[model samples]
Target: MSSNVGTSDSASIYRRSRRQPLAITSAVIGTTLEWFDYSVYAAVAAWIATEFFPSENSHVSLLSALAVFGVGFFFRPLGALFFGHMGDRKGRKHALAATIILMGASSLLIAVAPNYTSVGLLAPVLLVVARCAQGFSAGGEFAGGAAFLIEGAPEKRRGTYGAIHYMAIIFGNLLGAAIVASLIAVLSGDQMKLWGWRIPFLIGACAALVGLFLRARSTDTPIMQQAIMAGEIPDSPISETFRDMWKLVLRGVGLVCGFTIVTYAYVNMQSYIPAVTGLSAGTAQWLYSLSLAVQIPLIGFFGFLSDKVGRKPLMLAGAVLLTVCPIPVFALVATGSTPLVLLALIIVSVSIAVYAGPFTAAITELMPRRTRYTALSVSYGLAAALFGGTAGYVVTWLRFYTASPNAPAIYAAIAAALTLITVISTPETVHRDISK
Candidate 1:
């Protein structure tokens, strides 16, 4: 009897150890690929503007392209509704697998899309449709991926595990920036505008294939499995979430607001820097990529720290810094010096990383497992659609209207203030049992 018991225990331990790494990889790689696809669009936004929205007035063309970028975000909430329902009703693995395939197809579609010169209005329309598809896929990626990690993680280390999702996101952005920088370095201005922009989208499509394979092979989280066996999955997760968990949903929106604003502003600033400071696009992209690379380690460190020190303190501090530092950082970028611009980006990246590092765990812990995915997806999707998707457009429009380079910073500060309020009001969720 004792030998059989020991054998069973050993087998269970071995299986768990093996499964954990694969789950982590699936979560990270899948999210990374989706983010990479999305970031590619922003990284090459300048080239895309010229190619797809050719106009006598460059500003008008750029604004039109950005508006389309924002348009994609409007569809995210709908995606959340659909995918969130799937995740809650079917399983996390199923939802994640489906999202990856959808995102991959959309990215591939963008690679083959005709430019405005070739197809007239249909060109931008196709681009809009592709972006919306990507938005829909992304709507569920973060929440579902985070929920998967959180549910699988040991209670004490959920923060550390959850941080991997954000790390993947930064890595994805870094990869996108690197691709854009490489193209800019290798291609002439005309070459890049004509054909180079499509290369990143193609790369994104290929990477998505890899993510899809990994996610498809991965097993569902144990918590999700238990729910399935018990037949405890909610029939109407969206309605249930809104009915019982509205406060948690509101809190999620508030916490996500600053993150969306800061992240989008940081990304959009890469394009904005070259426009205002007269730096080469290659330099701006390289600096942006380097900044993101530096933040990856810092994000990991903070994620581990959140497990020890608590999520709220780090998040609150980050919110305070974001509220205070945007103006100074933008001033440094305006100097047009490579080193100063790099420094400015580093400062902003660090602040954002601090908050982002703990965000996934903190938000996921706020609700019960039954509606966790839906609640987080809906709130995050709404926040992103409202602020993140519109960030580049809003900043550009603000700068255009006010004729001030500081407009983006001012916008970030306002968003940060709202997040600060939310952080102050919400309790720390680091110790909560997600399985409840």
Candidate 2:
């Protein structure tokens, strides 16, 4: 009878162990769906803006549209603080589920908003409001997902699990790009500008609902639950994170410089280039989507390598390569040849993935369990806003002033340099036990 009892208990434990992997998979998928929902707006901005904004000057319209893109970043830190606090104080599973709901609601709102033709200034205002809500919800989604997977996975496989989260991000980007590309392929320009542009957002909103449902079923990490039970959890996570781990936050900002620029180039600038630099929008969309699809496998490969080679070396190499490569890379893209542009995009994408693939593990490992969500959120949100969110605006503003196309490269170079500082300061985190 005792033997049977022990066997039953062991089976239960094995079942839980199995559940953890599925939970992490859900977490990754949830985050990807959420971010992909946010990103599709930027991917289809030029078309959406023309349809909705109806400005006489294309450059001014694109700039206004992209400015609205940055507007979301402004709210991210606030969302990070609010949701990060909830994650640390409540649980990762709960916070993530809530964020998905908020994200989905905002996306749905955007999909159904009226155009300027129907509502005048109210159209843009509503768009900003929806984006702000999304920014706030997304602020904590990635950080929570990172911390959850890191804490839940076995120590030896933390890098692999953590990499899944980033894989989801790249996957989301590809999904968004593919959705937009497919629409463009079928629709005429007038049709796309008028109505087809909203389809991706509608799809994203639906995906977010699926993610929310999956997140509802995910279990909380054992470490977090134990901390709560032991009363070791802080009453106020944001204050505690700031007081205890400001250094880590600074390092996060520095690290984000590299991460953000790479993401900006791949996601934001892919669409921006055609609008601003005279590249064909159709060709740019296809190449960007194609390059991203090819790069996804490479991200997984590099992420696995990060565990063996150590996160620091890969990050350092990414920083160095980005610092030197941005100017020449952007110059080549400006030439308007689809082949050359695709080649340059892929090269930069591969170089950036070396760091991005491991960043979730590296950054989350730096903060203690007590403050992991808040610390990661603050670090990622602020850095992303400063560098990544503002990339298109700053680059365009620079181009407008200097009448030079080289300005975006300069922005990329500066951002990469900040990442170099982060690599110097950040220690390797692979295999670190979060329970400590």
Candidate 3:
């Protein structure tokens, strides 16, 4: 009887070990698909402008398209509120599954949306509605996914596991860039403007369907299960989080503001480079994609390093470098040399990875378990909406107003300085026990 019991216990343990990786894979797939959907709009914004926001002045059309893109971000905080409550009250698995479905549906809607030429004013109106839906789903997907991964991970490996959440983001961006580049390579510019833009959105919808299937098979994390069994789940997580954990939420905003600014600048640069430098659009896309690909392994390296040294030190180092490096890097990019531009992008990507890799784990540790999903979603969603969503539009307007090629670099530097202040004030959380 004792031998039989031991054998059964060993088999159960093995089964659990197998399940853990599947859980992580589900998180990765969901995050990747969400970001992929978001980025497709960005990747094809120029084409979207011509097809959906026609204007005599090309610049006016581009600005209008970007404005619509920014508008989507405004809905994120609302999504966070609704979905965060679901995750806290029901389960992370349930919230994530719902988010993936919403995102997939929105992307499909965008793919099939009629052009302005066909539907007139209603076309742009429909596009805005779909983008807002995507923004809402994304508001929950990231923070909810982060909380899921962090809770499921081994106590000591939280940083490394949380890093994967971000890695999926980078991978998703890379995928979008690659798809855009390939389309550009094969299609004439006129063809792209006519219909090529819709293809990426279609691809994004299909990818999201695959992600939803994977997520459906996964279970809630052990920490969430424990909370449910103990009846520790909050009745109103958003209200409870703000009422008691307001300070932590403020700190999260401060920490995220600079990261959002830097990241969006990097994302918009793919479009910026070709417009300003007269580089081949395909070449520019390839270079940006390559930089992101290289940064993935570097991100993992930094995440592992944080477990040994600490999250704060790596983050602080990154903040300082970002504050100081942008002016010089942008100068190199202005030279318009392919080699110089590639080098500058690579350096900036490395700095971004250093701080971003450990960010999710650190923040997860800071908030209490019961209200973590809601608090994190609210804080991150707000910062991303206010800073990240507006970055491309703001930078373009600054460049136009100042008539200076270096305006974006100055903006990044200021954002980085503000982040450095937050890093100094925030305590290290890598060693904290998150389950408490």
Candidate 3 residues lying further than 4 Å off, grouped into runs, are: 1-9
Q: Which candidate model has the greater TM-score, 1 or 2? A: 1
Give the per-residue Cα lDDT of candidate 3 at 427. 98
Estimated TM-score for each candidate: 0.98, 0.95, 0.97
TM-score of 1: 0.98
Candidates by lDDT, descending order:
1, 3, 2
Model 2 C-alpha lDDT per residue in residues 309-421, reported as the tens digit of each score: 87888878878877887888788787877778888888787877777777778888888888889999998889777777778777767766677788878778877888888
- Clashing pairs in model 1, backbone N/Cα/C closer than 3 A: none
Model 3 lDDT tens row, 326-354: 88878877888999999989988998898
- TM-score of candidate 3 versus the correct structure, residues matched by position: 0.97
Instruction: Look at candidate 3 and give me any clashing residue pairs.
Output: none
lDDT of 1: 0.88
